[model samples]
Target: MGHPNDDTDKHLRGSLTKQNKKLSRLKCSVHNYDWGIVGNNSQVARLFALNSGSDIDPYKPYAELWIGTHESGPSFVDHGNGRLESLSLKTWISDNPNLVLGERLLRSGAVLSAEKALSIQAHPDKDLAMVLHNSQSSVYRDDNHKPEMALALTEFEALLGFISVKELMDVLCSVPEIVELIGSGNAKQFLLVNEQYRDKNAKAVLQSIFSQLVLSSRNKIGAMISNIKSRLLPEMQKRKLTDKEQLVLRLESQCPADAGVIAAFLLSYVKLNHGEALYLGGNEPHAYICGEYIECMANSDNVVRAGLTSKHRDIQTLLSMLKYTQGFPEILRGVSLNPYTTRYLPPLDEFEIDLSILPQATSVVFPSVPGPSLFLFIKGKGAITAGISENDNVEEGEVLFVPAHTEIRITAESTELHLYRAGVNSRFFTIP
Candidate 1:
């Protein structure tokens, strides 16, 4: 067994959180491979533990961690309950106070992903979450405007928010080649609503126009992509910028610099390493994931994507939930280390954390462990024997998942390790 941890020192935190002293390791629920990982920086987080279940074969550097609940294959872990059980996140956090931090975390989970790029769709506010839930049982998970954050494992790339009308008009005008096909009917509609299009709304309208033109919206936007392949790719060959072009250039071959790229002009691009983090919360929306990242949020699984997904759009659903007036959507967090490790904070309660090196066996116990947690062992192979539990030892790439109110001890016996955790929350308690 590794050194025992003061549960209170490691887990129980708040304003009164007595500044964490002992290096801590909290378990989490990292779901089935989801959004595409940004293969950039990770040696900064230093959390690359040895886990048997990974995609890139022998494991390179630990990238991003996916910890939301969009269903799609929520990661399953070994529950401490005698048998290894798989539980959907939604059912586990019922009435769990920490999980319901003012109806915020759920809002974040319903959106982000790691595998297939999620479609561009907006989520309803509190009232709408209930209304949609009543009207269409499947789409609505809860009624909280979800805002999120993303810290670049290395230079991060994303298509966030909307572009102003003036900027979009310039992009549309640049590619006069397709003006003939833009059709007068919807074209006329755009002119009619032109005044209302501000930032993201304007971008969404442009995407809608482009989506209509795509030889196939439901299919691979392939034909349309092929049509513009020759002309738009010139910029990439001239690629000289150092920071981040939103990494959109990399996807140019796949998406082409069509009306969509311009209409969906990336509002901002950020590159972070070690301790930086991105916050996505409220109704501000964005899509596209590329890199190794650790994502965490509340406990619900529902996403209403419009562009990058093969699911439902619910036009009325998105139109009703958009933050039409929102310009800048989220707050970007910088990196700061806690002695040996670094913690990246997202908008909600959960965080995307990385520990540099595991010293023999450092231990930590949530002063108050969140009721429901599913820990995904992305990397690192170790013998995990929890607090006197009879279970033998868990190896690398194994999920050490625990249910609500499960307080236990953990130790990582490896040179270095990587783990992803989501939905770590607990009720309010006065330090006794």
Candidate 2:
């Protein structure tokens, strides 16, 4: 709860009288995490340096560049009053909801720049999110579901969803130590079952096997992990390794003697080349491995971590919430609406993304839209002119907040400009 005379209300009072406030350059927040790429090797660190106009340290693990109104790490909106006054994007949106978020996006969204592997986790759906938040406020934190899309800014790797039943069975057969943990009876039962991969009931069977593997007694898990290290590390040192094997080796290093190493083999491993994208909704079990990507999601952070984390793990809650369908996760190549723009439309109405590119000296106009939007400059330098006033120079790593029904024009000043526009879309909206 906020006070009545908050800065948000004061800023809105003067701005609402104006016909168009257009675009405002935003100062986003940065999160540093242990798993992030160390030092200037991180894209996030570079961006933070650029945004802060400070020298790079080359020693910090800059992790997440969060641009949004989310309470955890909200971006700040500059009032442009030549004073030191500023307001959180969340507060600004709250005060001028109709003017900023628009009718379609009464709910807003955010963009995240991830530099490393996030915890192996899933988010609860709307109903479950509310229940969890009310009952476990300290952990659940928020009542909104997080349905997200991650578009590769660089080569990205991730483990998404469950691997096919046949695939997991094969992995188990290859790693006898892991199979031994599940006991000979259960392993034999699972392997002998002849179930079609596409059958709906197949997921249930897969979950049972996976649950057994992940929830084995601590000593059993330790023995299996030790056995895997003994057998696999030598093999890796001697010769070539398969993609899945390589992933397993990597996870083992991060979380030694943890079941997540075994669990990684039961998940589909994916690599997204630059500019490619993938959409993940609530209850889809996934883990980012390493890479730089633009992640957009509904404004919530209720993560149910399963493993491969130092944070709290709610195994039962996480397992119960998963949409256990198994297969390779689909890679979404955004639909090209034009030569200049590609639209990444995820199923959720909370957000849609567009990657817009501009050739040197060329200009493009982003037409006024029904919802608020955030524009992030990923490559090249450009000048942005909003409506009839407020021009700003934007370079790589900077973000601009675009208000509802306000058009903006971008002109490239460098070889080429690449930027991403993310926001709630009217066409994608559906009453829930």
Candidate 3:
């Protein structure tokens, strides 16, 4: 038999240990950015309304819905006591890293639901992130490279990466203002260099054009926009506009005077249908033009913005950190693990995503995960009958945390159940 002192010691140790539940519900944090779609039209706002079970204000601009342990918008654990505990996700995970993330995912953190156009920016690599974080902690919060993937929740539009050298050359030749920015001599030289280096070093050739355009003067940019409007506006009204031309018109509405208006022509414009995905590595320059998507990044919030926003612009840093390359954008559809589930796998070891769409009154069993998992219910109602959490009710926009190695069985109530799971894949823990 244990002594009274021994029993007391055990109790104290239990209290000190993490109070996290095995399959606890999560109370996520939300960000109201200026770029967010106004009123209850915001998807983030709708999700928040479902979680709170209240009437949406319809006027608040809910820009982002964040889930995970990142300090910027850390989610809170729901203890099911009719009250949410004050403990943050990051601190809670730190208290029991192995239980939550296991060994692989302990290094990474957080997921996001972005509503409107995110800033035109790129993340620094790991080493550069560290230097930036250390030097300017306020601006660069964490020392982690953000290799993010976006699974389109709705039809999403973004300016991703660089356009082809030949295409860029055509724009340069066709637009008098673009020709003026780099001068006739340099433009001709760039074309010649592109022809010579197209097969060998395309990225370098693309970089030369991008650098000149990005570094152009405000007056030059103004002239370029004016010229574009004068030349293209009449044609835009007469015929079916191309995607790139449409983007120019959209940018004209948003920020006509901004240099990004000119810069947009240099980048490839992409639109992802619902359920499709896109992967962006660190140092890639991109700007989300519109629509909603689920964004998962490697636990960092360091964005070096160049333009298309009212926020602080870090043009020099952005120019210095970009990975200049041109290619047709690849839209990832994910690997289908089953009829009901598809897994989106990016190159980064930090995170991966699985989307499940269950039919009406159907039961689906998720394969046991080797690491901690985050599940977000996007559509319909469901009851999760999983290890340690029996008959737990999950509805649209509800978030859940499933501990490592826990068996998961979700059943649709009366309608289809749609959810996405993010976790560290088994590859990270396996010794190859």
Candidate 4:
């Protein structure tokens, strides 16, 4: 009514707004705060082309995948406004489930590809961890501990569950010098009961015997260990201990008598290569990540960690949650579908990932009708060109969310594509 050209201008403005909303705009950078891990305290995960460091550099455990939540390392995605802001992935998924998990959103299986073995420890059972964290004033983030599944992308090793009272006795008795630590009583019971002697009794015996044995070619404790062990481990020597066993010996040398390593061995031994994963939850005590994979889980920022680096050592808390029984963690693998699509399954419900590896130039359809989804380009390069011609490329670690009701199409240009898709699905039901 105001002017004849007003309707055309308004239509043009609406077109521009739709174009902007559907345009592909995403970026990534190596997590700098996640440097408290790796070889030293100063190691920073080198970032790619994107924003620069945005936090304190002093924090030691400095390696992180900046995707899901955690404001410190959230994936800075651009919203409708040209201005870029951090998006909370957890909330994003919860708001839109159809395009993410479809009908299987709740039946989620987050996958992990470790570049190196992580730590040998476990998160508490949900309630226990909650109570522990709730009771403590210093702990940060949510009290609901993470129950993760570690699937090895390569030859992976982990200490899953506890060693039995009997198995522990056998491993300790394997060395003659350690025999006295047991001394008539149940070695396990005595160490737990006798406070004054606990440190000096068993833990010390292990340290003196195992750590010293591998200290060097010539050492006091090492000499004693060598002398005592040759007899006790005659059969072990005859069979030649495994490489993992050798690695264990080396770790023992570094932290002799550490209950951590002893606890590590009590769990099961696992090894995997490409296309393999270890499904571990919070209760499973394993530490080591030696592969590269699409890692996804509930938006968690709490890690009840142990022996792997010289960082926070919650010895009592870690030990208190451990189950001293023999067990193993389940492993998940990927199924190749035409080299453009791969399905993965982990033993968890917090997250799931589907790798769509497209060759040359082609289009693929993902019928995501769940909630919201977090997608990334971890290999090759490609883009999801929504119906309006908006295109966002898939490059190493570049992520975006496929909101519910968005049936998108993606195509590669001038190269093969490797797309990493992951997100959280919260509809979980416990077996009664």
Best by lDDT: 2
lDDT of 1 by residue, 136-229 (tens): 7766755444444454434444556654566455445544433445655544455556365544356565555444543234233444444444
lDDT of 2 by residue, 63-99 (tens): 7777776566667765454221356666666666666
RMSD to the true structure for each prediction, in A, is: 9.9, 3.3, 4.9, 9.7
Model 1 TM: 0.57
Candidate 4 structure quality by residue, lDDT tens digits, 344-411: 65556666566776777887876634355556664556667655555755554445655554566777
Better model by TM-score, 1 or 2? 2
For residue 288, model 4's alpha carbon misses the true position, in angstroms, by 1.3
| Tens-place lDDT digits, model 3, residues 1-432 | 122365654543354354443576778777777778766777788887776556666777777777776566667765645356555555556666666554344324333334445667888989899999999999998788888888888888998888876777777677677777667886677667645665465566567656776677778777778888888889877887777877886776777677787788888889899889899988889999888888877766788888677788888888888877777679999988888899999986778888899998887887676678888887899889777566877889788877777888898885788898888865676746
lDDT value, candidate 3, whole model: 0.75
Worst 10 residues of 2 by lDDT: 103-112
Question: What TM value does model 3 have?
Answer: 0.89
Top-TM-score candidate index: 2
lDDT of each: 0.42, 0.76, 0.75, 0.49
Count clashing residue pairs in model 2: 0
Model 4 clashing-pair count: 49
Clashing pairs in 3: 39-58
